[model samples]
Target: MCRLTFFVVVLIPIIFGFCPPGNYEYQTNCYFFQNNPTGFSTAELNCVSIGGHLASIHDGFTNSLLTQQSLSFFNASTDFWIGLDNLQTMGNNWYWTDGGTFDFFDWSNGMPENLQTQNCVAISMIDGRWSNENCFLSKPYVCAINSAATTPPPSAYPCSGGFLYYEPTNSCYGVYTHQEDQTWSNSESYCESLKGHLTSVHNYAEFRLIAAFASYGKYAPWCGLFSNDGGRTWQWSDKSSADYLPWQPGYPSGSGPCVALAHSGLINADCNQEQPMICKIQL
Candidate 1:
């Protein structure tokens, strides 16, 4: 009788759908997105065209999963759109424009910097945070609709970079390079060919770390921020289409037709001039 009771207790959770949220691939909820490319606004519209609006981030686990997959589809102009917005004009008042309120939000240290006249929000790095920016900007963003959710492709990799010297846990990842320099097109091509994409520098810590590894003294390497708005907007090479803005003092000068990494080994470059390149791949 005791054994039977224990067995039933164990099976009760399975029967009642009472397992804790987990990281297992199967246990995770899946989201469906359109492969069609659209501008930030258009993407939102398209998402509405379906039954859903842009992708609304739910929780850390789900956000991380979405960000990881978003990075994989990234290219030189890979800033896909998401569902969060600051349309209310209040600073840091982010809500899913999809008409659903979000319960989970992650802000970087001193984030939502609101450094500029940002009105929209986008996801940065695998560590989820919302960036405020203009909505008119045309960056690649992901659009989520109501359908059977699906997992990201098997090739997906997170936006986080590996360690500099050595870390056992990071052995599966590779470090960003200081020696590699390629034209914007070439660099992007390089990453794609390797079944990887350009690395996204999400915050000051990440920017500083990658810069140090690249040995930047006064030169910057190319990163993944670009815009067709005559340099008015910058987007990472992902699908989050998160458009809140973050600029380090003087950035997106709006002068160059192209973007590059500059500022020593900081992966900062002038958008107009050709520079060396870096590529990221699974470790």
Candidate 2:
């Protein structure tokens, strides 16, 4: 008779206070739990309940590995959950769990065509491609709890008189608000009085913050942009458009007289419609 015996001991170091409650980063000691197969929204709630959030991949390398891991966990046949979801409206709108806009766009080639209502975002193993999937479907997910702060965000935009919050990334400015609602012209005047126009968010991060502080009662905001110059002639109040923007569908419509920034960051709506507006300040 022959017999073989083996022993293994695994030690998991309990790092005390590595990340604050409900905080996460990339490439750090982040906690991941695979249980109770959940959809995108449920998954986010789950992560949040555990003092964390759905993972966010900032770069290509991590994005690739994450997609692969999710596919493997789900038997390489089905999709799993991730932090990305376009459940905002229906068009090309996406947001991350960490209160940031979807700036790191890596959509599969010829994808996001909005071929169907599958607007929710998901990752795939077939060459780390990202595709829109049903938010109700359940799949394994690769989320980060605490990784690392990749780049030091740019300082908030400079506001002189009233107040200003600068976004270090895009050099964009946001207005400090104490109210839940403001009018388009009123917000515009508020920003103008301070020598700054309403906030003109050029990217997603600022959009996230703006949405949180401004968006109330399903209303968009009248950002520092307008089609008055012409249908395509949209410009920021700062008289700068160096960073060309890609507007979403059914936007800048002639019928929609007033324009307000949508919570999704890419879309804008009419003014009277009631959306969040930025209260700019002088810089």
Candidate 3:
């Protein structure tokens, strides 16, 4: 009786669909379950159209909640699409479509087979266990909607040549693309020549300043963030904290050991792709 009461109390809002009509409120985000069968890519696109991504679970509670909701929502006895996939071309690993951490999962035994053809993930409607499925298969999906970020102001401080000062992190940033487009290696070398390394982002406010560099208008430039084994871990070229990762929906899903900043967010790109770069020096 005690456990049931606690569970029911915790589920009040989620069970009542307290969000805008047809949406379920859970924590700070809203989830919308779509019963229509759709392919994984199509399902993700549908979610993104509403300023969110296909639901990405971070903990067991969320997993259980989705499972219970599936029983209440989806009529099919099969599976539903979630935002987990091993689409990164560089390695056979799974990542969240909303760019959340890849820490928790409840994969069924022998599941996530990692077959190249079965890269997308779906949750069982009956047990909520995860399984890697062919991306083309149609499945019901849930969308997790949330808020957005605000742009940051720009300023410069006297530290290094061609660097701008971002007060929050007490660091200087430089956008280098003048002489020629450079690969990630070349960009880091250029930054080293300026007594710094490729930029390392600490948070979203700093990221916004880097993305909307004045006049450049939403520049896509190489940053220090890189994952050696694809989507598992990230490190800065400057060896700074790499905590703030703002990725475009379903991003970090390509062949990547390199990262770049864009209006959408951090993206995985081929290291050899010549582009402008951002450099940072801790101050």
Candidate 4:
């Protein structure tokens, strides 16, 4: 008689808890593309319900990546809604839903039409270029979340009062309420006293986090952007060069010495003007 031996093997699959099912990861974000057609407003609400906002495209690499993903995941001739719209203000001035700069635009010829009727923006699957369309039009859409980096265990950090830890940049942000309004310089000093500085927005994620908190007040909050050398050069409070300036169209005429951030856009204001402020400290 002969004896035989057998062995068994078990395999485990890796799971990324930061992103939901059917979502792809890129850099520090997770993106989800929906194939079901819906109006832009409903799509935006759907994204928010899922803990993200409509996708905001920032650069060429991101654009190409999203274009390829859409081509692969969605059907041909499917136009997708992005987080860009000009409904907040007049003219063709568009802004990302996260309050980011409209830096990269791949518009089809004679596109964006500069018409108020077409306020929402979408990417054409046929050519990967962008075009303005009526917000009510039904279309598929994309959503983006900041990923695990933006959501850490709260017990790990020692943020106080209104200050909250933003895990993406490892920074803490706070909005203080004073007995009296303060000027931009005074606000900066107050933040410095707290071992931080006026919040400086480096990208859409950071800007969105700050904007959501700053939206409560009627007045715009002073950020870290300002001009020195008699308005010849502009820079952040940390002396960083202005790499991503999203000033409203025809703004920053080198007039005012300070900058304030509103839901509409960045505006230059007198340094002495009194307003609320946003502060940030790196951890």
- Compute each candidate's TM-score over C-alphas: 0.38, 0.48, 0.47, 0.53
The lDDT of each candidate is 0.46, 0.53, 0.69, 0.72
Best by TM-score: 4
Summing lDDT over every window of 10 consecutive residues in candidate 4, give the lowest-scoring window. Answer: 4-13
Better of 1 and 2 by TM-score: 2
Instruction: Mark the 10 consecutive residues where model 1 has the least summed lDDT.
Output: 4-13
Where is model 1 more than 4 Å wrong at Cα? 1-39, 77-79, 89-92, 148-283
lDDT of 2 by residue, 1-283 (tens): 2121111111122244454454333357464634456566556644543434577767887777665555435564555566776645455456677675566867778877653467556666566767878766776665555443232223322323323233343332443333345556666776676566776655554454454333332345567776664455666766666274535455656644345655444454555553455644434
Q: In model 2, which regions exceed 4 Å deviation?
A: 1-26, 29-54, 57-81, 86-118, 121-167, 170-182, 193-196, 204-216, 230-232, 256-258, 264-275, 280-283
Candidate 4: segments with Cα more than 4 A from true spot = 1-51, 54-158, 177-179
Q: Go through the candidates in order and give the clash count of each.
A: 35, 26, 0, 0
**Candidate 2 to truth, TM:** 0.48
Q: Highest lDDT: which candidate?
A: 4
- Measured with C-alpha atoms, the lDDT of residue 127 in candidate 3 is 83
Q: Please say which candidate is ahead in lDDT: 1 or 2.
A: 2
Between candidates 2 and 3, name the one with more favorable TM-score: 2
Q: Candidate 1 lDDT (Cα, whole model)? A: 0.46
For each candidate in turn, give its C-alpha RMSD to the true structure in angstroms: 18.6, 14.6, 14.9, 14.9
How much is the lDDT of residue 251 in candidate 3?
Answer: 81
lDDT of 3 by residue, 148-215 (tens): 21222222234444344545677766665544577899888877877788887776446544643411
